[model samples]
Target: MATFAMSDQLLVIIDPAARQTDGESVRIAKDVLSAGAAAKVCLPDGPAEFARALGRRGSRRPVVIGDDHALLRAVTLLHRERELAGCGLSVVPVGEAGETSLTQSLGVPGGAVAAARAVLDGTERRLDLLVDDSDGVVLTGLAIPPARRVPAPEPVASAAGRWYRTLLARTLPARPPRLPAVPAPGPTRLRVQLDGETLVDLDEPLESLTVTPGAPGTSGGGTAEVEFRPLSVGAEATPLRACGRTVTVTGPDFRYRADGAVSGPVRRRTWRLAEAAWGLVLPS
Candidate 1:
């Protein structure tokens, strides 16, 4: 393993959902961090407290111990304060596998021990972000049509197991709850614009769309990738893909999954790439 010059200052924020869903994992992560570094752990029950914990952090490097939502909250907070570029964030995923997809995608270790060790020994990596006109931030890719909630796993067998599960349900933060999947609202006409060029006009009905950080050219550069699929079944009309610094999506009212959060029902939304706007710590 590559040894890093460990920074003594570290503040670990444990999300309530993480503590509720998998207290054991959170505890293991806490133990690892505390033993390896000068770690100060904070347990925030709600969003307000979460923000306050981060705001009060002094020179300590902020480490979030939770699922994707926890990481998103931290990144959004830093982005809004315009401190993202200089901050290096670390995360230890402590929820169900489905709930921690964002962290996994970003190359964070899945196991609590590994993730915690990475916090103390990882190298910093610069990453891009997507910022909307409303000042919202997207650390991971956003999807059109949004994502359907991952169905809960089958219940455990045996009476004793069932009782233990039930106890957890009542006592925990709620297993990082997911919204029950709702049927799509039907095909909607949308006007998709890349940079200033029109990709999908208002007359064209779109089945779905996705915007991600990356440029749309032979040379990969700073830009957002915009892609959409039309409802029409044309072999020649495969999914339309393009790259640009800005992408605008306008429809009657539609929802999108940004990072892991679902948002929308607005008539218009614009997203632009903020290249290397933030840094994340990954295993060296």
Candidate 2:
């Protein structure tokens, strides 16, 4: 890995969503970054332009000014191009509080001003990565059988308001709305293996599964933590847990949520832990 210097040139990519969501934060980040060091700012209109801008960054350290999705896009592109290990990335999260959780969890500061300062005056920390067979990268963690969401109940209105709404509904022409198609049920039986050893078989029904990268600077030696809950008839069974460098899952077809994105109905998938695969700039 190359040494990161404070005086190095920076390529700042401002995602469109960041601009649309919070212009003030974007402007603040740009101001702070520009005042600190030499930076070339690129306002990309879409994903294609963002990729092109990042790809063209020659010697400049890449600093993403957007939300978690933007950071994921940058990292995924570099990983796919085989340039991730050599690149030292930084981020100034500019989005809703909930949307920027990934960056925050990775040690990037919350506010734009603080994160921008960290980019200029912080050290690069190498972090582990989880790479799947499909070439997808998971920064934080993933959960099998994506979580289900219950819709919120309709809000109650006052009597006069309800009466007015009833009158308006009778007067206005009603059009049949196109309803969303419901998703099919997911696979229940899955075979799980860790480091070439079978942990669970298809005959055993699993309640849930989760996999996460080892904590930074830990003695886990670049292994991922895997845990699964088994469905029991009478009493709740204790969840099985293990640490391994590789994990494999085989089933009819299952969907998983990783790092805030849902992917795969893949019959089989394997993920390998890449020890210290990438670097992120964080406050010292």
Candidate 3:
């Protein structure tokens, strides 16, 4: 890990989503960052402009001011250019709490002010990455079968019932306690292999599969945790788990979710762990 000085040059790329979602937070982030460093701000309107701004950054450190998607975009670009290992990326998460969960999971501070200050005073920590065969990068973990979508509830017919429900909602706490929805299992068959050894065969029905990159301070440099649940017959079967450097999946066309984005209906896919493939700035 390496600490950054206040005099360092920074290229601050503010995502358009952040501006539209929370202008005040973005402004505060800009104020703090500019006050502490030699910062050049870029307000890119779309994906093309965003890539251009990042590509044009010379010796300046790149700092992203947006949600997880923006951060993923920056990392993916740098990884594609083979510059991710050398560049230390910083992010100021700006969006709904759920939307920025990936950034938080990677140890970034929550608020705009705190995250911005970290950019000036934090240390650069090397992080692991999972790169797929298609050149897709996964900053965080990915799920084999994408989450199922639940339809919205039917609207009430009576206006009086609607009013009563509205009143009940208002009377409850800001976030009323509710149990997490358990997704009903669907029929999915996938052949999973770890490090070239088969973990599960195509004959078995798979309920879910997940792959996550190893954390920073772990012993192995290039390794990821893999877990998958086999659909049980009478009783719920225990999920099989393993840690390895590479994972391969083959079966019928299936979609997967990586870093909150959905992709593929491809028949086969493989991912290999890249040890210390990127750097992220985090608080000391």
Candidate 4:
């Protein structure tokens, strides 16, 4: 650890995966931070190193230079370390603009330089997170029962998929949008219980299911909600929200995505939502 002079500043953690860009992100980010204010930046090797950096200095605001996924990682780490409330987090997104800029929706921005600048002046606000007391901490999103999109085969596919998706984005509208491709066929049904009360037990095969925290513009409070929509023909539907501290969902083996990343083929799972668990630094 490097000795530091006391200053109103935050610790910056650059994602290892972001390093695949050969430090361009970090360099630009550092320059941004230095330009905006006096702060120290610590570059870590990987996820473990990032978390360790946080463990050592979570009390300080954390500004991550990476994608929304990295932001998710930070949130999960805060939850795991049981230091969610005391820490404030910020993010600088890098990657597919559409995909990466989603972090901006959380108050992060795309440019490393601009993002770092925001970190210096960003406002701290409480945010909601989904915590799986058993499996792990969920930061972004999750897929629950009634839909099994097993990602096909990820070995050579994920990259190819990204390339193809990127290429498609380049030709299409400059506006961000998900590919209009139809949802994958096949569905998995799930039974959901919120705060110990059964809310849904349906046989409808779902194309996808996701839960998002209440946004800055929205005021739902510490309420956690479960939404189910049939994927065979994916479309938005009225979602089910629960005001509870715990959520339990179980069914036959199913695939789930937590915070954009996939999680399980497990049959039973539970999520505990702790409200105002962490501080998020958003654009002001």
Candidate 5:
């Protein structure tokens, strides 16, 4: 394990959500970090400021005092700049348990004191990242048939407006009338390809799909765990699981949730693993 001294200069970035949602946690994190090192704190109100804070970082190692989304945002920004590999990140996750699942899974402590202390006393370990063709990056996991985004209801027509529309309809030969959009169906059919072998083809309807970073020995941390459940009427079919460096999914337009953020509706998407592309600070 690679270690760094506690006296290293540190730049701490506090996400607005964390400070707004939990002020005490932020204070605790600041106290913990300052006690061990020369620490400077920056409060970024929005995404733009967040990027500026990271972009302007000097020799100080950057640490995030926020939840999973904040951590992902920082990582994504660094990835875009091609500096992720050179910069080792530390996270003192400050949010509700449900909101910081990714940090917890990565072995970061959930409590403020423990996580902050780890940030100062931890060792750095390299980790893999999932890069998509669209230039999006994922840290933890990706799942399909994302949580549906309910559309706002259309405005109702007033009595006078309705009457006017009716009169206009009677006077003019209506070109094909536009109808409201129908929602896409749930439990869709998807064709999944792992590395070059087809796992679930378009012929089979799928209930759901998940792809997570595989363990170190599973595939050298350069492969993802791909699993899909088949929709069936009888007993539930056993899910199919495989690992590969690249995973592709296609079939009618669909969306996916990656690291808690929803993206897509495209007909096809592919994610390739970059082995140990970045380093994370964790308790030794």
Candidate 6:
């Protein structure tokens, strides 16, 4: 990997929704960054603004001061802005205990002080990103089992009010929706192709068709990626696929879960991997 210079002035973006009760993590993060260097810790108005902040991050490195979801958003932003050439990402996992190391594995830490210290002395590594032109930036794994669509949210006035409702609407939890259960016969169909070669073609019910960064094409320039795990479940007609960087899917309208967030609906999509597109802080 080529060596790139790291930045000292960091922009901290904290996810406000995640810090409802024990909100002092955000304050600790703010103080840490402001102590030794010029820092700006700001709450993103929303996810779109969060991406915009990262896009316009300039020479200042981005140190996300939130949960793993915030880390995902920052990575997604980095993936979309491949022109950065080299930019380091810092993450402070201020969420539940389970996902502490989960973020660390990706080279981020959970403690506010520890993650902030990494911003000061962490080694940078070349990491891969998932990109889908059809579905936009890809950061995390995708799960597509049959799920009941969420009902439309009620209108709100104030930003705080809207945030509250959106938070509640999303917190409904992930379970088999309370609907009239019924039985059906026949399996779902999916035709998967990688680099124009057919990988799977069938009328079988699929649990998931996971695609990862394939090895860069011998002649064509791109990520060297492949998918090994294909978890097939019971009978259903809903096609499911998980793409890492780049993927191309052909069929009817297909609903996809990208980076844990579910999209409305779309079909005939392609995904591609962006490599070394973003920088991440690792433990020394």
Worst 10 residues of 1 by lDDT: 214-223
Q: What do the candidate models score in CA lDDT, each in turn?
A: 0.82, 0.86, 0.88, 0.66, 0.84, 0.60
Model 3, range 1-284, lDDT digits (tens) per residue?
88999999999999999999999999999999999999999999999999999999999999999999999999999998988888989999998669899998898999999999999999888888899999999878899763565544454456678788788678976654444655755668889999999988899888889998987433235789998887764227666789999999999998899989889888999999998888899988
Which tens-of-lDDT digit does each residue in 111-188 have in candidate 2? Answer: 989999999988888889899998999999888853454444444355678788888679888745644545544336
Residue pairs of candidate 4 with colliding backbone atoms: 141-259, 146-188, 146-189, 147-188, 207-231
Per-residue lDDT tens digits for candidate 6, residues 114-194, read 777766667666565566764366543444444444544443446677778678679866545354434442333556667
Give candidate 1 misplaced runs (Cα > 4 Å).
1-4, 146-186, 215-220, 233-237
TM-score winner between candidates 1 and 3: 3
Structure candidate 5, residue pairs in collision: none
TM-score, per-candidate, Cα-based: 0.81, 0.86, 0.85, 0.73, 0.82, 0.67
Q: Candidate 6 has what TM-score?
A: 0.67
Q: Mark the 10 consecutive residues where model 4 has the least summed lDDT.
A: 147-156
Arrange candidates by TM-score, highest first: which order?
A: 2, 3, 5, 1, 4, 6
lDDT of 4 at 87: 72
* lDDT of each residue in 127-203, candidate 5, tens digit only: 87789998889888899852444565564366677788788778888556455665756567889988978888788
Model 1 C-alpha lDDT per residue in residues 65-108, reported as the tens digit of each score: 99998898899998899888877898999897699987888889
Assess candidate 2 and give its lDDT.
Answer: 0.86
RMSD in Å for candidate 1, one decimal? Answer: 8.3
- Give RMSD to native, each candidate: 8.3, 3.8, 6.1, 9.7, 7.1, 10.3
Question: lDDT order of candidates, best first?
Answer: 3, 2, 5, 1, 4, 6
In model 4, what lDDT does residue 241 have? 47
| Superposition TM-score, candidate 3 onto the true structure | 0.85
